[model samples]
Target: MKKHNYSAGPSILPQEVLEKAAAAILDFNNSGLSLIEISHRSKDFVAVMEEARSLALELLGLQGKGYQALFLHGGASLEFLMVPYNLMTKAGKAAYLDTGTWASGAIKEAKTFGETVVVASSKAENYTHIPKNYTVPTDADYFHCTSNNTIFGTQMTEFPDLGIPMVCDMSSDIFSRELDFSKFGLIYAGAQKNMGPAGVTLVVLKEDILGKTGRTIPNMLNLQQHIEKESMYNTPPVFATYTSLLTLQWLKNLGGIAEIEKRNNAKAELLYTEIDRNGLFKGTAVVEDRSKMNVTFLLEDESLTEKFDQSWKAADISGLNGHRSVGGYRASIYNAMPIESVQVLVDVMKELERTA
Candidate 1:
């Protein structure tokens, strides 16, 4: 049985994208060979690459900003180090907000390269809510922020206003909603969560922000290098990047981000409302800061988690278990997750409530 997938990264991709990806794997665009067999430098493949890059930038309306979009190999984990290396200068300090697991990881990695300042942190409250009222550095090299917290189920309601250039890790929520990119110097996200697959990562950087770090960054890790080469510095993750391109095409056909944002909000609201009203369940995130892509909840009886997983599986629903670090249940409702799927899970939750 095909179950509703709620895995965080490498999560769910649209069915249409999957179907088209499979067909391309066999023979892409009727080129008489499989996409996997095509040369990355081939004309046919190059056209696909250009289209993908164009669509990605077009989606963000990044035409006027002189920002270059790069679809590269390695997940966002690589970006944690690369962001600091390329942006954090020796004379400057980088500011980071400790939101949750991934944000903390970014902060930890940044310290090795330069002086990092923690502007705000929510660890004392167990990261249940987004921190409000924080100090933003005026002279910092760049301010790093995570738009969404996957493990703790919280999201930054309003990003901090820092005078310095803003750098963000949007790994889990990029392209999920509308946001102005003019305020950010750079934004990086692994494509697996919101775009398509596991092997590619997206980085959008403003032209003015590069070449300012004086430190010597490796060729592969430099944003300017990737930008100049158009993300084909090496062989690149051809298949995964193309799948992301196809996904972007699907998004455009579905009325772009506006239409998808409506659906995403509705799906999140439905699950969150049920968790809020359900007698045996309680939400792990604060109402104001809950993530629209991931709904996290806990049973009154923690011991029943395993049983809840089994029951949901028997009902043909899966991937609802929460991350181990912050455990109970996590329903990652990414863009591809349908409202009907959320309804199914809500019904299952009601059933469990009545039986209990």
Candidate 2:
């Protein structure tokens, strides 16, 4: 049976991208060696790295805008530590917006470096909404926020204009919509979500933001060192970076973020519309704050859970189960998820309601 994948991370990728990646794995660039066996410093892989970085900036409208894109090894979790290590001064503080589990995890990492202030949080409300009207400390080294919450399905529509550098973790929603990419001092995302796969993380930052924290950052955690080395301070994740390059190429060929955003909006609308209109279901996140990537919702009749589960499973729907913390269904309609797949889920929902 054909499965409609809705897993949150290491999620669905474009079918063409997957096919190309599989081909490369068997014979990268027609070379007899597998992509994994190639040296990171080789001419072919170097070209791949350079083009991937360049394409990332080009797609984001950040080219020639003093931004450097680095495809790093550790996931966004490492970036949580690297952010403060390379940006926060020995005495300087950092401010963060607590929007979800990952945002809270970032705050926890920052606290160990220096004073970390949570400017605003919706945690008390179970993170169903994004906190607003909160103040970020102007004196902080940098301000941090997560663009989207995958587990809870909340996204920040507007960002505050802090005089200080603004940092963001766009792990769940990067490249899915149009945004003012220049406003951010730093942006990082795990490739597993919308980019490529789990082994690589994309970090884009302004060149001027580094080498000012007054803390001696370790070479591995140093952004400037990685930049100077051109994202090759050590052996990079070969397969992950190449697959990400293929994915970026796919996006560029399909127009860009502007084009993908339209498809994403249509998918979100299709699913959320069903969740709201169907009497059997209800949305988990606030209407205005709902995520275009991950759509979290619940069945109105909890007693019908088994029937609904069986229904989706029978239809060959996978990864519809929500996180343990949320305890409902989450349909992660990422950039690559087709509207046709969404309609399948909506049909399942409608069928459940009719039979119940």
Candidate 3:
């Protein structure tokens, strides 16, 4: 039986991208050199780097608008520190909206560099809903938030413009939907979920937002230096970056973010309808705050967990387990995931309900 992948991070990728990536690993561009063995400075690899950066900006609709896109080494977790290190100063204050674990992590890092005000948080309700109607102080140097919560399965439907720089960690949901790209001063994502595999992170920043913190940032941590070097300040993750270029090409061929968003909505709606209609399961996130990328639900009867687990596994479903904090099931339907896989999961749920 064919298997369906729903792993949250390092998640599913387009089949063609995978095949192309594998071929490059053996003999990249028919150069008799594996992608892993090639020098990042080589013209072939440089072309890949340039194309990937350009494609990222093109997909976000920020081309030629003074926004630079960089493919870097650190994951989004490192960005939690880089954001504060480069943007928040000793006297400056930043405002953050705490939606989930990643948001809280960012807040913790920002507090180490400067004052960080948590404008709002849903922690009071175990982060089931996105905090709403909170005041973002105008005095803040920038406002930061996680666009989507992978752990709690909540996503911010709307973003607030506070007249300050806006920073977002879009790790789990980037390229999955369309958003106002111009509103954010910076957006960072680990290329593991929707974009590609692990090992590379994408950072898009407005040129004016950098060089304002007045603190001396290390060369590696300085976004300006990375941009100056054209993301070749050092040997980049050649294989990962090349794969990302292929994946971005695939997304562009599929009609970009608008097309992917439609499929994402359809997949989420199909699975969520099954969860709501089935007596054995119920969704975990609030109805209005549900994430289109990560659809989280739980077994209504905890005692039936083992039976349900076996049922889904028997059907060749993988990675339905939820985060430890949530203690339920999470279906991470990213951009590369087909609607048919979602239909399989829905059928499994319906089968469980009928058998029950």
lDDT of each: 0.88, 0.93, 0.92
Work out candidate 3's RMSD over C-alphas.
0.9
Q: What would the per-residue lDDT of candidate 2 be over residues 1-356, giving only the tens digit for each residue?
A: 45899999889998999898898888888889788888989899999999999999999999999999999988999999999999999999999999999999999999999899999999999999999899988899999999999999999999998899999999999999999999999999999999998999999999999989887888999999999999999999989999999989999999999999999999998898988899999998999999999999988889999999999998888999899887898889988898999999999999998999
> For residues 1-356, could you state the per-residue lDDT of candidate 1 as single tens digits?
56888888789999999999999999899988999999999998888888888888888888766888889887888999998898888888899999898899999999998789998899999999888888887988999999999888888768765678899999999888988877888899999899989999999888888888889889998888887887899998989989999999999999988889899989988998899898889998889999998888889987767767777888787788789887788889999988888898999889888877
The segments of candidate 3 whose C-alpha lies over 4 angstroms from its true place after superposition are: none
TM-score of 2: 0.99
Residues 181-282, model 3: lDDT tens digits:
999999999999889889999999999988888899999999999999999898998888999999999999999999999999999889888888898998
Q: What ordering of candidates by lDDT runs from best to worst?
A: 2, 3, 1
Clashing pairs in 1: none
Q: In model 1, what lDDT does residue 329 have?
A: 84
Each candidate structure's TM-score, on Cα atoms with residue i matched to residue i, is 0.98, 0.99, 0.99
Give the clashing residue pairs of candidate 3, or none: none
